[model samples]
Target: MSVNVIILNGVSSSGKTTLAKAIQKYSHEIWLHVAMDSFIAMLPDGREFDREWFPMVEVSREGEVLPQMTNGPSGEALLLEMRRLVRGLSETGFNVIVDEVAEADTIADYRGRLGNGCLVVKVDAPLSELERRERERGDRLIGLAREQSERVHNGISYDLEVDTHAQTPDALARLILERIAA
Candidate 1:
């Protein structure tokens, strides 16, 4: 059987990783959870925080602080390499679940590469709830959810939409499995 890839796109603390893990745990199919965060975490020391390499800025609006990442050439190259890695895994018949916060251009880039067997899912949560989750997680950079709230889903539609605030991760994973089976 040909492998299927489910791409979960959302902002920080939107539960994409949680849902991806839930899907892998509960689903009968052996699914590889491939997260862009993992690829980003693999970046050489200091590269992720270096402005010359990654080019991030902090902006404050209405007392809310947020970070803006401008992925310069180096960052873009890494993203492309990560996308290709996901593609290669799927092409080799590994069912993959990708967790990413992708804007329109990045989504388009993946669409062109992954082609027919890929399903794009929009993982959503309200900004308020996302902010709360980010705070609770403690590991995420503060304001990341707010920074991405408006841009992550811009100009994109999905094969499935799941709101983390509305359902449990297992419930959402089950729903995705049903959709895939259909």
Candidate 2:
């Protein structure tokens, strides 16, 4: 089946965003990149502790700082609209690339939102590599990768699975292209 949307599902810091950009850069067809973070960024004033915004990170008894951001109302509304936007874009015949941290609920939601014309790709890396990347980036919550690494793919299935720990985004994108073309 032909698809207009590609969803890259993975934990934070797994390079889904980089892969999406690489796919856009190299693809013969132009695609619009829609990232879940783009909606998160729309939260007013970037509030973290509002409990209506991102609600801040949680700490475990073992001193693990986990940023398990379950969106409060405002964030939820934004995400809902983002999914709708993706659906609308694909319906309009635009090729779309989605960079997402797919938890169980959103995976199911995306299936309904993106319709039949979508490809879900599992983007992943080892937890160690993910943590390293997160620390190297220094812009994300310290434990987001650790927190999400275990849960992102729990209930989701994908058309392709790619590991990014030892590869560049461009190479990975080429692999995805070749596999899909097959």
Candidate 2 lDDT by residue in tens digits, 1-182: 46888899998889998899899888898989999888777656657447876676574635765767677787777778889999899888898888888787887898887666788899999889999999999888888888888677897777888899878899999987776566
Off by over 4 Å in 1: 1-3, 60-65
Top-lDDT structure, candidate number: 1
- Residue-level lDDT of model 1, residues 86-133, one tens digit each, is 889988888999999899888888888888678899999888999999
Model 1 score (lDDT): 0.86
Candidate 1: TM-score?
0.92
TM-score per prediction, in order, is 0.92, 0.91
The number of clashing residue pairs in model 1 is 0
Candidate 2, pairs of clashing residues: none
Q: Which stretches in model 2 have alpha-carbon errors above 4 Å? A: 59-65
Worst 10 residues of 2 by lDDT: 56-65
